[model samples]
Target: MSAPRLTLPSPAKLNLMLHILGRREDGYHELQTIFQFLDYGDEITFAVRDDGVIRLHTEFAGVPHDSNLIVRAAKQLQEQSACPLGIDIWIEKVLPMGGGIGGGSSNAATTLLGLNHLWQLGWNEDRLAALGLSLGADVPVFVRGHAAFAEGVGEKLTPVDPEEPWYLVLVPQVSVSTAEIFSDPLLTRDTPPIKVRPVPKGNGRNDCLPVVARRYPDVRNALNLLGKFTEAKLTGTGSCVFGGFPSKAEADKVSALLTETLTGFVAKGSNISMLHRKLQSLL
Candidate 1:
């Protein structure tokens, strides 16, 4: 008989605000960011295998099997925990790659949580998040499944309930290379850290905007178009730009107008991830 399978939502994250404090001696930048989940994202399905071989049935062009975060995450979990079970993984991808939407990192976190459940490893969130940090800076937030105030290369998390708004996100038809953005000599790396708790409103600025806009005209154009409707901002080192509205209808209305010129979607922002909500329902 085929093994029982579990499918979970791998929700995308918006870096609501990203500030680079300074560059560390180790070549990693110290960052302060707020992460919030969108109600929309890709979906991943997993099934256990008796053979100790991790395999991902879904293939991404140019991303090798071992290099894909889903496969790497599975292997990392299996190796770390010394679990004998393996998993067959598949994904229905909707999130754009290199759009600054955290698709790959989200996939990795989903793999970790899914395998942990199926294998009955019983690892806690802290342990899972620690392992996830090794995979990517953004992975721990997805693993923790919360909107957070993240610091220290995006691993240190402080749970904060930010106002959930409806967001219209525009996907520019170009990929933004994060490494390129960070390495650019003109990039801002000196934003002062926020010392107060509950970051003030109007703190949604992303320091990478000027550099990203200068590098990618598509991103600059998207920001310009969306800015007419609301306070449009770039999320992370983005090729995707977003603006929030008071309601879904309002967001959709703007999305309709903007998407006529550029591709985009409307999604409600959530402090709690849709992935965790689904996981809770199963209990």
Candidate 2:
């Protein structure tokens, strides 16, 4: 008999809008953003081990085993919860690294939730999300599995229901370094915060776009090509640009046209993450 195993979707997220209000004393930017999930992403599988040794069987090039976010997340949860069991983790890598699409953070969150379930730790979402935040700023949104209005270095989340639209997302060949983008003197760090509940429509702008577009020609080219079909906007400190369409057919049509010159995909925007939906089905 084999040890129990579970596989979960590690979904990607888009920062629908990102506003950098100021730089904090700690050098972290004060950001206000909306995070919405996409139906498409990587998948992660976990098998339990009673001997209590956390391990990731899948190797990511350039990211060592212990340093991988999935491994770190599993180790963190095991230590924090004082859970005796360990996990063997594997990932079907699909999402591009450093694409500004919350791939790593989502994988970390999935590890936390998966181990929590398989280990029978019975930890609540709040506790899990708090642990996840120490891993990355975007992890809490994945843990909570909802579209959110996020503030305070992307930790403070207020659930929001944004209209789910089909998205055509283009992947630029180059990976944009988020640290480089944030540290650029040309980057906008002073967008005024939105005070009202349910942010207004015209606020769908990412503050990092200008700086990112200037530094990465691939990103700039993607934006220019995708912009021809719809209102293309960068997500977070992006190497990925996305535009919303009313229907999957419309989004797919544009994806087919643009993928000739660049790589891209079409997926429906989701308020509730697919990971949570799968977890719920087991209940």
Candidate 3:
């Protein structure tokens, strides 16, 4: 008998330390970040079908039916393949929008990974990752399903075994536009790029903090509060910040403290992606 259809978790990511080293002539910022997969994120369920019609069951609130990343990914896959296949894409969005958490990118990555198997398309990891890179720099990490140190507009990923564990992530009530942050005249674009090396221990910093703090006071305040617990740092651009703790209980303690202070939020610890791990189990 054929294996059961797969339901995957497209995990969110925290920029443990995001640094803007410089800008390329192509207008993309060269950056460095320790990317960690979160325990919670968006979920996408897929089922193979005989008829070659793609359908989306979600309205996705503000996003259009046709323009959703899942659909876009599906079309990207179907256009390249000789096989005829259909899928039912259902997305349960747990990650916040405009939070620099790569929610949409993860969804797109999951779609690409799922359809490759469901439709029986023969593309391997490198091919899927290459396709994912064209979609977005962040998409490739989700395609690979592991934590890493990333560079080059956040595309170059080196699999990191990161003293990997629980990290207390805090998403502030305010949403920061990544484009706006990158576009700001005050953004430092020449901090000197660092080659991928050992994942630096906790003291690593995000260069965008000063720029983000000056414009978004709420983020600064959140960082201040989290600092009381551990050496807190801003993730990606701003709006969401995180601090590392040794244990889940400690992480939860910090999260509880945030509950009384900031309002809009997502507080969770680090985790490995289960999407393809489950696939491995079935295989």
Candidate 4:
């Protein structure tokens, strides 16, 4: 009999507030940021293979099969668990690449969690998160599936319950390169860290904004346009800019006005990821 396919949501995340603490000698920056999920994102489906041949049937433009994070994540889990099983993976790509929405990282996390459950490896969350960290700094938060305050290259996470607001996220017509932003000479590398609990009010700012806005007019125009309605901020090193509203109606109302000239979407912010919600349903 063919193995039953398991499909799950791979939610996108926003860095609601991003602060750069400092840079390490290894060329990594220490950061403090708050993460929250969007109810909207891509979907991934997995089918287990007994003969141990792993494959990703979906094609991501400009991303090689070996270099794809989803494939790497699945291979990592299969190798580390010493499991004689593999998976056929497919993703419905909804989130834009290099949009600063954690698209690739979320897909990797979903693969790790999905494979662990499907293959019956019985690995713990901490072990899985550690494996995820090897993929990217953002992967662990997605693996943990919590809205959190993240620090220390974004590996150290403290769960926090921030307001779940509806967001109008505008997609600028250009892709922003994270490496380019981080390497810019004018980028800020020092913002003092704050208390772990009770994040200060009016703290939603991204340090990468200045460099990104200066480099990409599309991002700047989107930010400027959105700022007319509410406080707009960039998430991570962004090609997408967002502003939060009190309700879905308010968010959609604004999105309708701006989208005539720019591409965008409205989604309710989520403290608990859809991935974890789906996992709980399986219990």
The segments of candidate 2 whose C-alpha lies over 4 angstroms from its true place after superposition are none
Separately for all candidates shown, the number of backbone clashes (residues 3 or more apart, or on different chains) is 0, 0, 0, 0
lDDT for each candidate structure: 0.92, 0.92, 0.79, 0.93
> Could you give candidate 2's per-residue lDDT for residues 1-283 as a string of tens digits?
8999999999999989999999999999999999999999999999999999988988899998899999999988989889889888889999999999999999999999899899999999999999999999999999999999999999999998888999999999888999999999998888888963766695468999999999999999999998899888999899899999999999988888999889988999999999999999987
Model 4, poorest ten-residue lDDT window? 196-205
Sorted by lDDT, highest first, which candidate order results? 4, 2, 1, 3
Error of 3 at 222 (Å): 1.4
How big is the RMSD of model 3?
2.3
Q: Which stretches of candidate 3 lie over 4 Å from their true place?
A: 1-4, 263-272
Of candidate 2, the 10-residue stretch with the lowest lDDT total is 195-204
Could you tell me which residue pairs clash in candidate 1? none
lDDT of 4 by residue, 1-283 (tens): 9886899999999999999989998999999999999999999999998899899999888899989999999999989889998799988988999999999999999999999999988899999999999999999999999999999999999998898999999989788988899999999987888887777686557899999999999999999999999999999999989999999999999999999999999998999999999998997
Error of 4 at 20 (Å): 0.7
Off by over 4 Å in 1: none
Model 4 ranges off by over 4 Å: none
In terms of TM-score, how similar is model 2 to the real structure? 0.98
